[model samples]
Target: MPELDSSSMTNPGSKRSNNEDCFLSLPAQDLWMVADGMGGHDAGEVASAIVRDTLAKYPDLPLSESIQRAHQAILDAAANGIGAEGMGSTIVALKHHGENFEIAWVGDSRAYQFTPELGLQALTTDHSYVQMLLESGAINSIDAESHPDKNIITQCLGSQEMETVRVDSLTRPWQPEQWLLLCSDGLTDELSHAEISAILQRYRTPDQATRELVKAALNAGGRDNITVQVIAAPSQPKPSMRAALAHWVPIFTHSRRLDAIIYTLALLVLFALLYWTIF
Candidate 1:
């Protein structure tokens, strides 16, 4: 199994005094997640926290099953008056089994894949009103970006109207050096896909990429709680012994002693070739 390097960051943004977004990165368990909460007061924070805690507590469960449980957990919390009524959250979760990976999500929080070849590709489609409009050709991409109802989600966890949350999922082979990005809409709302792709291309490591992305979002006007998780497949293995030797050959040749030895070997090879031709 290829090793995975993961990093995560969450910020309250410039306009928000409190952050209602939460994330989890468990490389050991091959799990990662991001949750964006919604509600009045601190209920959003409570809802997001429940999502994080519930998913963390049930690492052994399947990704879809675990997310369903998280939904039920939030509903239970609201029923018991643990949080304000109507508090809910959007979520995106990822898990890997060797080279194969799965991503499950709800609401508008998103999952994306990045590679040198593909640049940035969205893995999960948004469950937002704007998305519905785009699918129905009622609006174009540019119109959706500034749509008044862009933030209105069609489904999410802990909805009083929903008995069971509808979870969307996808499975794919995770290639080496590819990056998996899970983030709340706060990041997307502030940064365009092209802008995000540029940042990821600029930063080579997950930690650097996550930090820069958050900074860019803030610079672009952070309107909501921003959360991001970047997971990268293991880098290519070290070069072979022959390649390593070739890499050092020029440096070694700069030494007079090694230069003399190399010259001697070349002469000996030439002489052996001549001798073999004569024989």
Candidate 2:
């Protein structure tokens, strides 16, 4: 199996006094996360910290389950009166397993995938009122991005209703040599998809890409807390003849052709057995 290369950066942005965002990067575990804390005062920071700590605590768990644990922790903290008034946080996480990836998130924080062939595509949907309106045809995408309610997220951790708490998720085969980007809404609010795609295309390494992304977002206004994470799958390696055979042999064996042949043989045997009994 191949390994993943990852890099991350976080900033308070131009207007904020302190950064309330938190991130987790565990390349060995092939897990990465970003959380944007909400609520005034330091409560936001506390919520974000709890999200990060809880999400990273169990590397062995699935990404969805990890987020569930994180959400519960925030709920617990809120009950204890630890700067938890109206406190909640948005989270986006990606876990690489074998040749597939697991993605889970809440609120407006998002994940994106970029490849030279496909350009840039969003992997997760924003859980905000604007998103809801856009989906309902109440507002166009251009209007939604700049809407007043764009920042008002519909779901996140620390909410009183735990039963309704759920993380949106997606799983797909990992595209090798592709770039995976995750960030808080601060970066997206400031930069457009084309701008982010350009920066990702220009930079070769995850560190360079993530740095330039945050820098560009700050230069564009930086109204909120910003955090960026980038992960790249290892480049494809040339396979030897033996390795190639090992990879494709199983696929061929279980393909539609083999199934058709087996079905045909079974039908023929049944026909012959019936003919012998009748004779």
Which is the leading candidate under lDDT?
1
Instruction: List ranges where model 1 is wrong by over 4 Å.
Output: 1-3, 238-279
Error at 235, model 1, angstroms: 3.5
lDDT of 2 by residue, 61-179 (tens): 97778788888888888888887677889999999977778889999999999997887899999888889999999999889878988898888888876644678999988786798
TM-score against truth, every candidate: 0.86, 0.84
lDDT of 2: 0.87
For candidate 1, lDDT tens digit of each residue in 127-182?
Answer: 98899999999999999989999999999999989889889999999786799999
Per-candidate local distance difference test? 0.91, 0.87
Error of 1 at 20 (Å): 0.6
Could you tell me the TM-score of candidate 2? 0.84
List where candidate 2 sits over 4 angstroms from the true fold. Answer: 241-279
